[model samples]
Target: MRSDTAALTTITLPEIRLRVRDAHKLRGYFGELFREHSPLLHNHYEDGTFRQQYPLVQYKVLDGTPTLVGLGEGAALLVELFLRIRELDIDGRHYPVQAKHIEHRTEAIGPVAGLRRYRFETLWMPLNQDNHRQYQTQSAAEQQAQLTRILTNNMLALLKAVGAYASDMPLLLVHLLPGEPVVTQFKNQSMLGFMGEFVANIALPDGVGLGKSVARGFGAVRRVD
Candidate 1:
């Protein structure tokens, strides 16, 4: 594997924060806004500039308020494109929202921590492996192996997304909180396993996400330690 051990020039990412009113149950809110304003978002990108290297525009609802996190330096442009709205229509529900910006906290974020250890917790949704049903019929040891594979796949994707392809990343230890299965909005008309209360201890960067539907805030991970 190749590695870029050179120091990365720090880039300050600005989050497009928003406060929503009268929306207690916002399952697919983020997906809706981007879908509704696809053109407005698309206009900002030059041809072939918007590759999915960790979602240049990451969307999430924090503290019951929706936010669009600009992963790139040019991400703040999204705020200008949508901030003029008094309200946004997400998943057929009109939510009154206030939009603004704030710098993402990055002081303690890194792929390798001081102790080579990190603890991650889900913000809104859970860490879904998409292998929930397989676990039901497996032995305890087999289940653990399956779970680790799922988490490892997730972490590997994150590392690749950020161009971190150094060797030995696969040896990293990962533990996941048992996710309960429930119906989610992704399939719309079908019920599937939706992970809840996901937590992990792995050597990875802070603020990176895992599992399925990360673009719509399904598996949000943050540093807890």
Candidate 2:
């Protein structure tokens, strides 16, 4: 049983309303605003190279409000820039910010004793190009099993990103609730995304995004229990 702690910071623009589809635009706005910290903000190098690691800072539009979540070092960076964010410029339109709220927490990243239920507040994309093709050919049960395995892997990746490597890999099971997946557009291409709940024997911080395109806020989860 190994556990590690990381700083988590969430900044929400409560008074500002933005379309969920403009999450990437919010990322772009902040990334350019803080170019010196572009790597931490957008996971891009100054030379325009992509950082091949988990994004510590993620942008999201949850419930029609622009939100920023940062973990570990990124948390500190977000705190540093929180006071500087006064407005948003999206698609040549200006939206002035009025009231903002920020929360900080020290979250545990490790295995848990009991299964915990989590709901995907945002769409969860568990398939890539290769798996997308294979996922369509599988039976319903097989698809669920495949998604379970991928989710377990996703948990491991998140733990590794926070430097919390479990000495003994915990038993991870993702029992997806009965629901139909939604087809969403990502990068102009249609993708299958799931918006439901699952039970896992691990604890994750709220506002943390998982799966692909997490930096753009695709897979945000919150514990229901």
Each prediction's TM-score versus the true structure = 0.58, 0.95
Error of 1 at 63 (Å): 2.3
Model 2 spans > 4 angstroms off = none
Name the candidate that leads on lDDT.
2
Steric collisions counted per model? 0, 0
Summarize candidate 1's per-residue lDDT along 57-104 as a digit string, tens digits: 455555555554443332444544544535656546565554444444
RMSD of 2: 1.4
Give each model's whole-structure lDDT.
0.45, 0.87
| Candidate 1 backbone collisions, by pair | none
- Tens-digit per-residue lDDT, 1-225, candidate 2: 555788999999998888887888999999888988648897889788998888999999999989999998889899989899999999999988888899988998778777889999988888888999999999999988888888888888888888876667766656777268789887788889988888887889988988998988888999998
TM-score of model 2 vs. true structure: 0.95
TM-score, candidate 1, is 0.58
